[model samples]
Target: MLRKTESSIIFIQQLGRGLRKHADKEFVTIIDFIGNYKNNYLIPIALSGDKSLNKDTIRRMMKDTSYINGVSTINFEEIAREQIYKSITNNNLTELRKLKEAYHELKNRMGHRPTMHDFITNESIDPIVIVKPHKCYYQFLKRINEDISELTSYEQQVLTMLSLEILDGKRIHEIILLELLFQNDQVAYDDYVTTLEQLNCRTDSNTLSSVIRVMDLTFFVAAQRKNYGDTPICNLKDGAFHLNDDIRRSFDTNETFKDMFLMSYYVQRKKQEPMIVALH
Candidate 1:
């Protein structure tokens, strides 16, 4: 019996079978059969990451409905956990160059990192050839300088929590709390509360407030409103807690991120309501 390969590239390779470009067709269709086996649970683990494969992990992953459509789940707790992968030798240089070019070209085309499967579907290479090199996904992203591997473990956990799967699993209040972390890193306190209330989950405001405090200790830090003697200075007046300006800038710029952020912050602050702005 032909079974599905968990490798993202494998899916892409198979899609290559009879795949053709049609500008009129906006979607590609896949037909897969989920077999009856104790080892079926492991596929979720592979799709997830290097983390342990267990019932909870798979459950959370399946919550992400944003992945592929129409895929259903079995009773994960009842299924036996089995690791079903083998070691493969690295892909030759020619193969590596192909990968680099495919990814880079996609980045240029998409204006962001290309999903592995997208590369397989679009590139005219066999999916088997892509996976033969045995490189981990994280290794490939780092090689191309599009970084996700550098994320702190806390960030990864938050990402997992805020992912479409887990967010879809939780209550509306919980979803609002996580959405605070969308495109912008920081937001205002009132906006957090207001967004949560949009769904009429009024019971969560106090709890959500507490969760923000906990997230500050572990996943993020907050900037408090402060004072210089009697004068009010830089502080969060219900603003969102985020990676300080410096850290945020450091991710993209080489100039001392923290220092630059501070300088810029002060410059902008002074200019905002100033009759005259200067620094000594």
Candidate 2:
């Protein structure tokens, strides 16, 4: 039940098995099955890239990329939360601290980060010790900046709207344009005043025009104008607005959106909203 320095050998072994050339083989297909299939810090680690051991490198790689699905890490469910908490607290961190150190050493020594369950299985500790209570092991990861943070509420909402915009191709621009006005990111004129009036926001045409100008510096949306130098909302040529090409491209493959979606899903299971306990 205890085998230190075996993970690295297994890692190399698996790849070596598939890497053997054959006429029937098209290419080497490496599939790492993992329960905690989330986050991107391990991308460079998997490829054995430069700065693979550096947390900054991982964060930079994560941010610059489209998305991360942690295929190499195993995620454990909370089973004996109370028992784990009790064990560590009663021990006064002597054993806990040692395990934490081992976790780091194992990562470097094993050539890959090992899961808490993996540690429990390979070491003389209870699997439930780090499996259940989140922080016992979380603090260890935080020391190394290997912890994955959850998403915020506003960011999640933005992603929802963005995803909807993508699915609703015909109305994406029109929907977001209306959303700009709804969010007060854009201004409307006489007809817009009518829209605001419908919303019970009391404002005259000139005041609305001024407000629109003040808030029109949108990064993802642009308003159309009439040839007569006036904002138009009724005429397709003058009133319709469009989404920026670059912003749309970013939305197509944004890691932030994917992270938020997963975090929201996780939180929803607990009956508490995601951002109620956001990561930073």
Candidate 3:
């Protein structure tokens, strides 16, 4: 089909007409010209009937056409694949309407509100992206008018910090240390190093200290620090690290916030890999 279509349903409908049986018709050759379009990523989603909305899944589908079943085959030129990859990477999946649609779709499927873990497990848009435009997921929900509990200012601040700094899963040291503190309330510095060693993560002093600085907001510039209220989530004492008392109390009292925070960690844990440090 030579027609350009933005909607997967319309694209499939157009292709379906050409696949219909006809008298004396042996085989049909379909050629789709992929121009410089931003929605080129939808080609695989339409072909595979996949609604995961994950870029990696779409890329894998492009690489392997075996999912089509039977003797039918599909192929893409190298340049076309590159174009689709660019489209997938450059398209903003976190647009407000798109986010709302993804949220409600999952919510309807599960018969209740979906958590960050739900989004991760469903292979929907990354939860980190969902929380990007707002202060946190809670704020996003509020923007969509979902029924959610009200958050105190402190609770909002903590969630905002977690969303902005740690939810991306880029560097996971802060997540590891925070999880340790949540489990034990306090963790010795030596024990923390031992934990990293056991996990095969980098245990150098510089890396370890940087983790603490990030959690305590010392790693950020002043302008960036203002976004998180210029407060530390953890404290370093003589020989150990401790979760801030107010944050700890909030974690204990606010089950919703605790669930969201732990859900973020769970999602990151699935995406986490051992940190590789170079020796100079």
Best by TM-score: 3
Candidate 1 lDDT (Cα, 0 to 1): 0.40
TM-score of each: 0.32, 0.21, 0.80
lDDT score at residue 5, model 3, on the 0-100 scale = 86
Q: Clashing residue pairs in candidate 2, if any? A: 37-70, 38-70, 187-212, 232-239
lDDT tens per residue, model 2, 189-269: 445545545544446556544443422332234421221112222121245333333333334466544443332222222
For every candidate in turn, the CA RMSD to the true structure comes to 15.0, 19.7, 4.7
> How badly does each model clash, as a count of residue pairs?
6, 4, 0
Cα displacement (angstroms), candidate 1, residue 105, comes to 14
Residue 168, candidate 3: Cα error in Å is: 0.5
lDDT scores of the candidates, listed in order: 0.40, 0.37, 0.80
In candidate 1 the C-alpha lDDT for residue 187 amounts to 68
**lDDT tens digits by residue: candidate 1, 1-280:** 1555645456445656635668886555544444543334445544444222223434555555243444433232322222221111121323566567756766788787654344434543322233324223333455557655354333222232222122223334333443344346766767767764554445455676645543343322222111101111112334654543433444465332223223222322222323222111
Task: Give me the runs in candidate 1 sitting further than 4 Å from their true place.
Answer: 1-112, 115-140, 143-186, 201-206, 218-243, 251-280
Q: After superposition, how far is residue 207 of candidate 2 from its true place, in Å?
A: 3.2
Candidate order by TM-score, decreasing, is 3, 1, 2
